[model samples]
Target: MILRRFFSSSFRLVSSSSSSSSSKLGGGCHRDGFRAVSSMPEPCQSSPLSDDESCDFDWDSLGFGLMPTDYMYIMKCSKDGKFERGQMSRYGNIELSPSAGVLNYGQGLFEGLKAYRKRDGGFRLFRPDQNALRMMTGAERMCMPSPSIEQFVDAVKQITIANRRWVPPLGKGSLYIRPLLIGTGPVLGLAPAPEYTFLIYASPVRNYFKEGSAPLNLYVENEFVRASRGGTGGVKTISNYAPVLKAITRAKSRGFSDVLYLDSVNKRDLEEVSSCNIFLVKGNVISTPATNGTILPGVTRKSIIEIARDRGYEVEERAINMEELFDAHEVFCTGTAVGVAPVGSITCMDRRIEYQTGADTTCQELYSTLVGIQTGTIEDKMGWTVEIS
Candidate 1:
C-alpha cells in the first residue's frame, strides 16, 4: 500500500487549559480501574507556574481561545518502534527540523475532547475512548503511529489533573483537551518520518462561536467542496482543516456563523459544516449525512444520535439533499467544539431558509440532555462518562 507523506519543518503547537484557581487539582481514575500514568521526569514533578490556588484568571470571560496551561504530555516512537512511555513537560514552544514529516508533507492527526468539573468537586471525561478510537483511524489514514486507547485516556487524565486549576467551575465552561500525533522526524523526500510524537494539551473554553448560545446562521457553499470519495475527509487529519479555512473565512466575511459544504461529486448532497456534522428535524424524524468515506463522524453527533433514538425519535443516516433544509422543521449542528447548536438560517444561492430556535426545539432538548450527562447532573445510563480524579 502506498502511504501518505508526512513532513513539515516549522509549526508551533497551540493548546488550551482551564480557568483560575488557588489550590492544586486532584488526580483522576479510569472507569476500568486505570490509574493516571506517572512520569519519571524530575523536572515535571513541579509545575512551571506557581502552585497558588488563585491563578488571577477570569473564568466568566473565558471564550474559545488559547490559554496556556502549566503542563503538557508527550511521547515519542520511531518508524519501526512502539510507544513505550510518555512524560509530562512544561507547556511551551517545541522546536522541529525544517524537513520534519509534519512540516514538509503533512502526516499528522489530532483529537479534541473536554473535561468538565463535576458539581461534587470532581472531574469527568465524556467518552474519551471514542476520541482515542477516532484518532487511531485518522493515524492509519495519515500514515502515523498512534497511542493505544488506554495510553491516550491515561495521558489525558494526567494532563487535565496537572492543569486542574484551569478547569472552569461547575456550569461555567470546560477544559478543552487537544491531543496531537505528528511525524517529528526529519525527512527530505516524500515518505513517512523516522520518528513520531504524541502530545496532549488543554485550554479552558466557553462557547466556540462568538454568538455564544444564540442560534447559528449558516451559508451553504456549492463552489467549495470539503472532501470527496477516497480522500482524507473521513479522518481528523491536520491537513483536512487548512483547506476549509478559505471557505470558512469567506462565509464569516459574509456575516455567517460557518460554512456548510456539499459533496464534491454530487454537489446537491449536504456533507457537513466546516467543522461539525449537520442534522435536520421534521416532525419526529431526524436525518444527518451518512459517514460514508466523506464526513468526519463527530463524537457529539454519535451521542446525540443515540440520545435521540432513546427519546423515541426516528433517526436516519443517509444522503441529505440540499433541498431538505427548506422542508425541515428544525436544523442543528454537532461537534466537539459547537456542541448541539441550532441553525437559525441556511443561505444557498439566492435562497435563505430559516428554522425554529426556541427552547422546546429538538436541538435545544438534545443540547440540554447532552450537557447534563456530560456535567454529571443527569445519570449516565449509557456508561459514557469516566471520572478522573
Candidate 2:
C-alpha cells in the first residue's frame, strides 16, 4: 500500500524519442526494434561532454549520492514476452502504474559495479562479467528476463562511456554503475508482471560509508535477522535491501558504522554486515561466513579469497562463530562500494571487542592491493580488469 501510493503520485510517463537528437553507440540502433532518445532540452545537441564542460565539476568533493549524469541505458519487454533491443536515453524519470509488480510484489533486482579512470586517460571496469552472471542468476529467480552477458557488458560500457566525464580523477573516486531490472507492468494479483524494464545508470561515488577507508565500528545485531534459508539472500534482489535499513539506521544512530547480522536460526554464527561481506583474520588464516543460502556471494569477497590465497595466506569459507570473531586478531568487510574496510571494534550484546587497525595490518595490505589493481596502479595479474573502449 505504501509503495503503491508513492508510485501512483510520483511516477511520470517517459517522453517520446522524437523530442530530441539521438547519439547511438556500441551497435545499439533504432533498427533493432527500438528507438533511442535524449532527454536533454533543446540546444544541447549531444550527450557526451563538450570542451567547455570538461573541467566544470569539482571531482574532489563527490560523495556517494545520485548526481545524475548525461545518459542512461534502458530496455523493455512487453506482455507478449519479447525483449526489445535497448537504447541510450538521457537520464530522467519514467512512468509506471500504481500496481506495478515492483511496487506491489517486490519483483526487482539490481547490480553495482564501478568504472575507473585510468592513468593513461582510458577507462576500465573491474570484473564486470561477474556482475553480469550474477544478474542473470538473480533475474531467473525473480522471474524477469535479463539481458545476455554480452548485452549486459555492452550496455555498461556504453553508459559508462556516455557519462565518461563523470568518472572522476584516478584517486578521487570511481563512477558507480547501477543496473536495475524491475517488473513494470500493472498486476492485480500476487504474480509476475507482464512487462519489465531494465535500466543502467551511473553516479560518481567516493565511499559507501562516510568513513572512507578508515576503520569501522560495528554493532552485532542478534535481534534482527538479515535472511534465512531458501530466501532471496543469495541474489541481488531489491526486496532484500529495504528491510535492513531499520537495523542499519538504529546502529548508526548509536555511533556505529553498520550492523553485523547473525544467522537467523542459531543467532551464533555470523551472517554479514548490512551491505558488505565480513572477513576475520587470526594469525595467517583468513575465515569468513560461508555463502550458505542466507549470505550473498559478494564479487569483492570472491576476488579477495583468490588474492589472499595467491599471496600465500590460508583462506577458509565456513560459518564463523561469534566467539571466534571476538578472538580474531583483525576484522574487515569487502564489497563493491566498501572496497576493503577494516573493522575497529564490534559491540556484541554488552561486550565490546576491539582489534588492531594500524597501517601494518593484513586488511590494510589487502585493501591497498585491491584498490591499486582497481585504479590501475598495481599490475593486474589475475586478468580481472576490463578496458572500456
Candidate 3:
C-alpha cells in the first residue's frame, strides 16, 4: 500500500511542486531526439513482505559491494537544460555514445548516502539534503546541469521506496544509495557535453572495511596526494578519484587498510584518506583538515563535528600537520561508507604509532552517538535524519 500510494498520486510530486523554471519542460525523456523513454506500464508490486519474512539473499553476509536492486530512478536533460522530471525504471545498463563527454573527458559526479531501517521497522535517511547540495556544487564545477535539491531528494526517496524490499533488515546493514550526474551526450571538442543525465541506484551494504567495526591500520603516503588547491579536489568529480587508485592499491598491498594523503603542494599537512575524512583527537580537542579548496567536505565529517561540539568537545577546522597527527591521542575516519572508525595505528615512513581503541575511548563514544542517532536508538536532537515513510 505504501508503494501503491507513492506511485498513484505522489509520483509526480517533484514536477508538480517545483517552482524552478526548469520544470517548464514537458514530462518525458528525449535523448537529443535520438531515443525516447519506454512507454511500457510499470510492473505491479507484490504483497509487502512481513517483518517475520527474510530476504532472498543472505543478509548476514552483506558487504560493501554492489548488489543490484529491482529499480532505479533516471532523468535526462541537455547541457543548457534543466532537470524537470524523472521516473523509476528497472535497473539495467544505459546506452551511451563513444563520444560521450563522460567517457571522453570524464565529465561526471557522484554522491553517496544510506537509508537505515529503524528499530520500529520504519526507514530513515541521514542528511540527504546535504548530499543534494553537495551534488549541486559538484555539478556546477563539472559544468553540468543538476536536479533541484527537492528533485534530488525526491528521486532518492522514490528509488528507495521502489526497492524497499531490497533494504536489508534492521541492524543487518542498510541500503546504500548512489546518485550519479554524468555527461551523456556526444561531444567532439574538448568542452562540456551538450546533454546530461541524473541517475540514482542503490545496494544493500554493510561495513566498508573487511575488518568490520574494528580499528583500521592506515599508511601515511608521502609519495602521493589525494587533492590540491584550486583543483577539483574540493568538489566531488569523477576525475578527482581515479588518480589515487595507485596509491591506495600500493598501500593495501603493504597490508594497510587505506592511505592517508597529504597536501600535494606541501606534502606535509594532513589531507584525507582515499575515500573518507580524517579526524585527530588530542585531550579534549578534536581537529580535522579544513575544506580549503583541497579537501572534499564530507557529510559525515560535518555531522560528527557538530555532534562533538554538542558533546562539549572543542572542534577545530584548520590545517593539521603529520607531526601533530602522530602526536594525537586518538584518530578516526568518517564518511558515508566508513561511518566512524577508529584508527588503531598509523605508519609514517618507518615510524608507527598506535592509538587507543575499543570501549570507553572518544572514538567509541562518538561512534555510538552517531550510529545511535542514525538508527533511532538515541534522540535526534539536531533534527538531522529524514524519515523515508
Candidate 4:
C-alpha cells in the first residue's frame, strides 16, 4: 500500500546536470531541463503508464487510501541553502538514515490537494496556491527551507500532468495530491537537518469518511487536547497530527465518525475536528472558529467562508462555545479530504444533541456549489480552478 519513487543516489551536494544549463535553483525544476542528480535514469523524459496499462485497477473500488500511481516528483535542498534540480521517477522505496531529523526530532511538513477531471477530459486543480502558501508557512516554522509558491504550484502541476492517466474519470473520484517536505539529513543532536527532501505523490481517492454524503456522528472529546496556544497548531507541521491518533481511533471504535476537539486553554470553545474545520449555521448566519493559533486554516474552510458570504449569508469568524454549537440549526466540517459533511448529532459529556441533515440543508448546498466549481460544471468567477492538461 506504501509505494514510493526513489532515485539511486542519496542526498549529496552536486553540480547541475549538463542538460540543465538554463535551469536555476530555488525556483523549480524546468520541464525540459530537469535531470536526476545521481546515476539514475532520466525520469522526466520517461512517459507514464499507457492508458490501457493504467486501467488494470477498478476505479470504482478506490477509497481514500494510497494506491500509488506511475510517477512522483522529488527534489532536495542542502545545508548550504541550495536546492538541486528536481526529477520524476518510477514509484518504489526510499532509504533514509536511522538518525534522520524527521525520525528523531519530527522536522517535517506536508500538504494535501486534489486534481479533478473536468467533463472536457482535462484536469483542474482547486486553489493549489493556498496549499503552497500554507506549506511555506509550515516550512518556516519547522526550521527548514521550502519551495517558493511558484515552485510549489509548478511542481504539483508537473506531477499531475505526468500521471494524468491515473486520474479517475469524471464523477468517479479525484487524484489526491500529497506534497511532503522532510528532513532527510542525519542529526545526532536536536537541530535542523543538513539536507531536506521535497516530494509529491498522487493517489486516486473518493470520500474521506466512510459515511460519504451521509451525515456524520461526532463525539465531543473533553479529555484530550489537540493543540495549545503559541504552539505548532497554527502551522501544518508533521508533528502536530500523530498525537491525536489515539483519540481519533477511540472515537471511531465507538462508532463515531470523528471527535470534535475543544480549545486547550479554555476547554469550552470548539476548536476543530480531527482532520477538518468546524462550522455552525444559525438561521441565515454561518460561523466558524477564528484561526488564532490552534485551528488550521483549511483551504476548503476559506472557500466556504467566501462562498457563504457571496450567497448572501452573514459569515462570522469568532470563538464558538460548545453550547452555541449544540443549539445551532446546522453543523458541518470542511477540509480537503472531507469536502463538506453535515453533522447528524454530537455526544458531549453523555448528553446527545442532534441536528437536521438532508439534501436541502446548508451543508449540502455548499458541498454542491464547491464540487460544481471544482469539476467545472459551475462558473469559476473567482478564478479558483487551474486547468492542467
Candidate 5:
C-alpha cells in the first residue's frame, strides 16, 4: 500500500494570534459557546504585508495559489484517543517529518467550501453543515478522527472573521475555505497512523472557467480506474487524490481540464472527476452517478438535486454509464470550488462528443440560482444559508 501527501512541506508548527477583529467566516468569529483563544504559541515566519497588499490583490487576475493571510485555525489530537477544539492564528509554513504517515501512506482527508460577502455586505456560508458532514464521512473512511460538526463549523467561522477582508464582494470573488486532515503518526509499517492533523485555512479565489460559455471538453479513459468497489472513492482523502494527479496532468496536456473516470471493475460506468462529481441532464430529468460507495457525495451536488427538484425537475441517483452521459443534453461537474461546471464534450480514443456548453441551460440555471443563494440574492427557502455574525 503506497500513500502520498498532497504537499511536500505543508505542515507548520505554530503558536500565536494577531488582532482579533477578523471577518465572519461561517465559524462565527465571536461565538462564546466554543471559544477561540486569540493567542499564539509560535511566532509566524511568513509575515503578512500591509492590509492593502493582502486584501487588494486583483480579484480578477487571480489564479489558484495561497496568498498569505493574517491567520489560520489548528487543533491537535492526542494518541490517548482524545482531541481538543482549535483557535485562529497567522498563516505560515507547517513542520512535519520527511516520513510522516501522510507522507508515507497517505492517510488523510479534507474538505472545501467558501465564505462570501452577501449583497447586504455581510459574510455567509452556503450550507457549511454539508461540508462538516462530508468531512466526517471522509474521516470515517480514512480511519482518522472526526471533528464535531459544530466545532468544525465554528473553527471556519473564527478564521474567516479574523481574515474577513479577503472575503470578496458579492460580484468580485470569494474566500476559499480548506479544512484539511492527515495522519501524523510516525512509523515505517504500511498501516493507518494513530495520530493526525486537522487544520482549516482560507484562500481568496476567482471563478474556475471551463470553456467558451459551454460545457468542458473531457477525455474519457476506459483503461484507468479511479476507485474500486469498497475503495475510498467517496471519501475525500489526500491518498485518493495522488493516484489521479498523473492522469489529470496527462489529460490536461491533451487539451482537457480533467478526466472522466470509470468504475474500477467494468470500466463502463461513470464515477466522477478527479476533484468533483458529475451530472447529466436528459430532457426534464437529471441524473448523476449514485454514491454506490465509490463517489464523493458532494455538498453542492446534493443541494443542486434538491433545488432542482423543488423547482419541479426530476432527478435520478443511480449507475450512470458512459454511454448515457455522452448522449446527455449536458454534462457538468460540481464541488465547493468551481460551484457547477458544464462539460461540453467527451474525448474518447478517436472520437469526441459535444453538447451545449453555457447558454440558457439547466446547468447554468442551477449555477446561477446556487450562486444567488450563497450571495444572499435569492430567497433561501430551505434554510441552508448560515449567516455569520
Candidate 6:
C-alpha cells in the first residue's frame, strides 16, 4: 500500500477561493471544510427496513469487493448557485449525458474515507472532516461545485446510518465511504458543466492493502511523473490515476507491487505513491517529500505529522531525491485507503535499494500509533475521530 497524496496541483483552476464564513461544527467541522452547493434532486422517501429484512452480507471476511448496499446520497448543482441537501435512496444507476463534462473533458473529483465500528458497538467516522475539506479543495481545482462541509458530512452520516449493518464489527473492518462530485451537463464545447452531481457510496472493506503488513517492492520509473510543479498533483481528480495504470501493470507483470514516481520537473525529488504518501525514517529524523503541489495531501499523512510532533521526533517535509532515499533506514507510505505500507526496497533500472523493516524504526512506531487510534485501541489526542452509531 502507498500514501498517494490526495490533492495534487492542477493547471485547470486559475481562480482564488475564499473561506466559507461559518463555524457550526466543532473545530471547524461545520465550516471551512466544504464548498457551498445547491439543493439536491427529489429525495427518495422510504423508511429503512429492519436489518434482518434489509439486504444482508457477510460483513466479516469482506475482502476488497463491492457489496452494494440498498441506498446512496446525492446532491446536484449548476453554473448558477451552490449545492443543496441530498437525499438517501435505494442504490442504483445514475443518469448522465453522453457528452457530460466528466465523459469528455474529465471534470471530476473524489474522496475516500471509512467509518469504523467501536468495541462498544457504536460506529465512528475516522476524521471525515479532513476528507470533506480535501474533496472541496479538489473540486475547486477542477472548476466544479464545492459541497459544504455540512452537506458532505451529513450525507455520509445519513447514508452510512441508513445502512449501519454493513459496518463490520470491532476489529472486523469499516464502511468505506466514497463521495464523488462530477459534471453531468451536456457540454462538448470545452467549458464547465452547467449541472453537477455530488454522490456518496459505501463499501465494506476489511483492508485496502490486500497484502497487509508484508514488505513491498516498488519500481521507480523516474520516467512517468505522478504530478509535477504547477500541475494537478495536489487535486483528487480521476484523470491523474488513469495515467499510472500502464506503468503499474508493467511492474506487476514483473512481480512488483507499485510504482514510485519521482518529481516530474527535476527527477531528483520524491513526489508520492500512486495512492499514498511516502515517508523515510533515517535513524531518528523522519522525512517526507515537501508538498510542492504534485503530491496528494493524505489524511494519514496529516495524522502522522501530528503524532510525530507530539512524540518530539525530528520530522522534516523537504525535497527528498531518489539518491537520498537509498541511505534511509526504513520507509513507509500512508493514505486513507492504503493505510500505512512499509516499503522494503526500491528498484530502478537494474539497481535496487533495500531497507530494514524492523520494529525499532519510527515508521513502525507511527504505523502502530495510527492503527491504534483508528481501531479504538489508543486515545485520540487531536480530536480526529467522529462516532456514528
Q: What are the lDDT scores of the predictions, listed in order?
A: 0.80, 0.80, 0.82, 0.80, 0.72, 0.73
Clashing pairs in 3: none
Better of 5 and 6 by TM-score: 6
Candidate 4, residues 56-152, lDDT tens digits: the string is 4677787788776666777777334655566666654666778888899999898999999887777899999999889888877777777767667
TM-score: which candidate is best?
A: 3
Each candidate's TM vs. the true structure? 0.87, 0.87, 0.90, 0.87, 0.84, 0.85
Model 3 C-alpha lDDT per residue in residues 1-389, reported as the tens digit of each score: 12333333323212223323253221332356223243434333343423343357788888998887766777777434776467666666677889988999999999999998876767889999999999888887877777888888887887777677778887889999999988877889998877788888898899999899889999999987787778899888989989999998998999999999999988989999999999999999999999998899999999999999999999999999899966899999999999999999999877999999999988889999999999989999999998866
Q: How much is the lDDT of residue 83 in candidate 1?
A: 61
Error of 1 at 64 (Å): 0.4
Better of 1 and 6 by TM-score: 1
Error of 4 at 370 (Å): 0.4
Cα lDDT tens digits for candidate 5, 1-389: 11111222433223222212211111211111122343444332333322332354566666556665666777656434444546554565666656667889887778888898876556888788888788877776666666667667777776666677777767777889898877665658886665666678787876665452346778887767788888888778877877888898899988897888998888888899878898889888999889988898889999999989988999999997777855688888898877888887888656888877666889989999998988888888889988875
lDDT: worst 10-residue window of model 2:
1-10
Native-structure RMSD, model 6: 9.5
- For candidate 5, the 10 contiguous residues with the lowest summed lDDT are 22-31
Clashes of each: 29, 0, 0, 1, 26, 28
Q: Which ranges of candidate 4 are over 4 A from the true structure?
A: 1-54
Q: Is candidate 1 or candidate 3 better by lDDT?
A: 3
Error of 1 at 73 (Å): 0.6
Better of 2 and 6 by lDDT: 2
Give candidates' CA RMSD values in order: 10.3, 8.3, 4.2, 6.4, 8.9, 9.5
Candidate 2 residue-wise lDDT, 283-359, digit = tens? 99999999987899999999999999998999999988899977899999999988998999999887899998979
